[model samples]
Target: MCRRSSGYYAPTLAALALSATLGLAALSAPVAARWARTTSVAIGAGLLVLTAIPWWHGVTTKTPLREMPVHGNWALPGEYEKIGRKLGAAVEKAPVRSAGEVGALAYFCECQVVDKFSDRARLVERINDARERSWLYRLNYLMLDTDELERDRLKPDYWLDWRSGPNVGVGGWSTTGVYRGSGHFELRPDRPAHKPHPDDQGQLPSQASK
Candidate 1:
């Protein structure tokens, strides 16, 4: 796994954006204790209200793991753990290697796994993006490691295609399969999964040609 400063600072920046109202709410009087208490209580109350639905439903109705989405393209996250088992089985039973982007999907793929952040085929692209940006943004964006070693590029058996239109099955990669939004979109490979015609058994594990 590679560490990027963006991981830390992006959320910090978001938190700052969220508290922008504080800039507007600043008072002329000096009351540090009172001010802090009022803001804390407000934040707490807002949080409680946000959780009111799920908390109440869980306590009273006992909702299922697959939570119904409140709006578009939004659902419970981390279903990839369960779906990974299915993908692992599928690739083994099928004739293809693997490809994916989502960390959770990659994590549970049960393949000849490499560190996705370091060993990913796409690392060069991200590193290029980081390098292309101005130096000042480096501390808050994808960090660059000037001396980082580049891995050999290898294409996998399947190409994962993640859509963001609807939250359902991809049906298939193209023609027959309709592209829905993402739930397990990575599992929906762009091309049919297959190994080279003269399939070699001595190669890496089937699931991760990542």
Candidate 2:
């Protein structure tokens, strides 16, 4: 998705810069008005073609312009959904820092979702009364690439590889502790569970963690 922005802008910026340079070149050339006009037209045509290259590349590559599969929906294939479900169940079993920590893990798994949090005060009150579970499942909606999931199923050592880092499979992007753009993350059952800050619910990015 981020690549699309550069793909659109870089070519246009190049064209503008080239046009400005051509204008300066025309001014310095001691040609007659007719010759100058013809040169400008030729340069302008070349600039247009150059500017259109990005669009041409898109057509050739068949790149998706948008992320969403349908209007106002984020539905993914069932295989990915199953993968997410399996991951989420595993997260529930694993000792985690916070409910959202599991969600963050899932995000790295390409889930792209965070469970909605409830009122902290009320939750604390319930915890004090021992009326609710100490932790909650705050991350849901785990999604993965169906094709990749299918491919992994055929490999004998896929489960071991997944345990280390699913994103770092035998093929491309085989770097450990890195999932797409998200960094190293894993469920450590031995470590203490994470707790959310009091102001975390609505805190701004400017507010640094203690």
Candidate 3:
């Protein structure tokens, strides 16, 4: 959200600047009053249109929501576990160096979590705890950090890409990314027993050991 002062003053400043330039032009020579008025009107209209285009585009475009492929029985590699554990430990450390520094780190950590975890419940729980002690701006950071952690753990062999757009019901917009495994992991036709399926009988799919 735009802060009150900047949002209120920017347009006013722009108008003042424009008016000052036009006044100087009028003072330099005996320009017709009609000509000065026309020029000012044209400049104001141009500025309005230029500023409104991005807002209009955002309202009109229906951005697509992209989903990453869910892998079956994906193993959390030792390296992933190592990194996750280290990050988790660091996050749990007591009393950051300063409130400002804590806030910044918390913000970054939340993004990492979201990029890693996505929508996992367990990870979300852990992130929620971490966020509680963080600054208010850092709340969303927790959700994002959990997402990142999950993504990294589930697909260690792949790279993910993201695109930005509006979010549903969330007022503001956000970026969503897709991730796929590299050649190191290929799709198996025989779906793993532990895989989450729409029509699974009561059987638990075999999970890969971390």
All models: lDDT? 0.44, 0.37, 0.36
Cα miss at 202, model 3 (Å)? 59
Query: Which candidate tops lDDT?
Result: 1
Instruction: Pull out the clashing pairs in model 1.
Output: 96-194, 166-181, 172-177
Q: Per-residue lDDT for 49-122 in model 3, tens only?
A: 86578556645672331111232211223323332344335544322211111222234333233221232433
lDDT of 2 by residue, 10-64 (tens): 6777777677667756675565556666666777788679768856776667555
lDDT at position 140, candidate 2: 16
**Which one is best on TM-score?**
1
lDDT of 1 by residue, 1-210 (tens): 111122344476557645754653554246565775577677767765765765576657745534332322211233545555556666653322333333444456665333334344434544445446656435644454433534454445554444444444544221111123443344434453453221222222322374
- TM values, all candidates: 0.40, 0.30, 0.28
**In what order do the candidates fall by lDDT, top score first?**
1, 2, 3
Candidate 2: residue pairs that collide: 97-193, 97-194
What value does the lDDT take at residue 164 in candidate 2? 28
